[model samples]
Target chain A: MKVVVQEALFDPWEEVRNYQQQNLPRGKHGGSVIFVGTMRDFNEGVDGISRMYLDHYPGMTEKHIERVCEDAMNEWDIMDAYVVHRVGEINPDEPIVLVAVWSRHRAMAFDACRFIINDLKHRAPFWKREQRPEGEHWVEGNTADERAARIAS
Target chain B: MKVSVKYFANMRDRMGRADETVELDEGATVASLWAKVSDEPMPENTLIAVNMEYTNTEEALKDGDEVAFFPPVTGG
Candidate 1:
């Protein structure tokens, strides 16, 4: 299993290439799955989002993200996994985070990818501050995120 | 003792700076700093991370600590 975390402005493609490998599914080892999260321009009838502030609990963020990956490894025969999350400052249309997983079979890869991303959404010690054209506010946590996390628990 | 108080994102904007060195009375706790800084109206959306870990405003703080005060996170 592999996990990476960094702070970047906005570069989804570059970050994705970092973890993608040619030998992903060699002997059916090619069950590769990827998840990309993009920032939206508008929210809740609000005009639009200019930029967003991504914050993380420095110490806990890394550890918690790793734990999510470890959990996936335990249930499946996953070979490798990579999780990259950027922090600092990010704007709309930016790629905030990416989770890539590889396994000998497709099922494990897809399930692991979904599990990792879902867990991170709910449990990671990160918060967002949205800056819309009209004004700004802290993006409230969604019930969906909480419910998604509960399933894994 | 003097500790490094870091401000990130909007917190940095509202605090008008990213970091500062503050002198705390001996035995100062996290609550004490909140009581002191909360009055500044830096920003309502700000959260505190003490010693590189996210912490509630009421948590205790000690000397030689590195605290980062910033807005909520938006990461995958």
Candidate 2:
């Protein structure tokens, strides 16, 4: 498993290729699932977001992501998983994060990929501040209680 | 006891600094640390973590603990 927290933009295809080359043996995995999250021009039904500034705890962000990946690995029968999240300033339409999982069966790959992304959304310690034409605002979403409820049900 | 208090996102902006070493009483919990550091009222739904793990305000603190406080996360 590989977990990365960086500010540089990444090529999703190149990342997948590198992960497979370095971690997976040929014919060892039958299926791979990948998810890329990109910065959008709008959020929370508000449009015209010009850019986004992502902030994270330096020493803790990577560790939290690794823990989330480990949890997914333990819950599924996946061979390998990789997560890359970008921080700092990001323009609209740029990639923000990536999650990929390799498994011998498509079922495990799909399930594990979903689980990792969902868990990352709830568990990761990253914050976003949006710059707009009018002004800047911090985006607020589900609270911890709401997140716990969603996970429980 | 000296505890490292780190802020992120808007909290960092509001505090005008990223992090600082705060002096608190021994056996201080996360809540007391937050009250000591933040001048403004703690925002609703602010998240706290200790030593890289998610923690509640009531959790007891030890000397040299790294404490972080920030707003709710908004990442995908």
**TM-scores, in order shown?**
0.68, 0.92
lDDT of 1 by residue, B17-73 (tens): 767777788877766775665565535656667775557766766777887776654
lDDT of 1 by residue, A11-101 (tens): 5566556555443444556577888887777766666788877776666688878878888999888988888787767777778788888
Model 2 misplaced regions, further than 4 Å: A142-153, B39-41
User: Which pairs, if any, clash in model 2?
Assistant: none
Residue-wise C-alpha lDDT for candidate 2, range B31-56, written one tens digit per residue:
88878886667887888899989889
**Lowest lDDT block of 10, candidate 1 chain A:** A18-27
Error of 2 at A77 (Å): 0.6
Best by lDDT: 2
Going through the candidates in order, their DockQ values are 0.32, 0.70
Error of 2 at A152 (Å): 6.1
Model 2: per-residue Cα lDDT over A54-95, one tens digit each: 877877888888887898889999999999999999999999
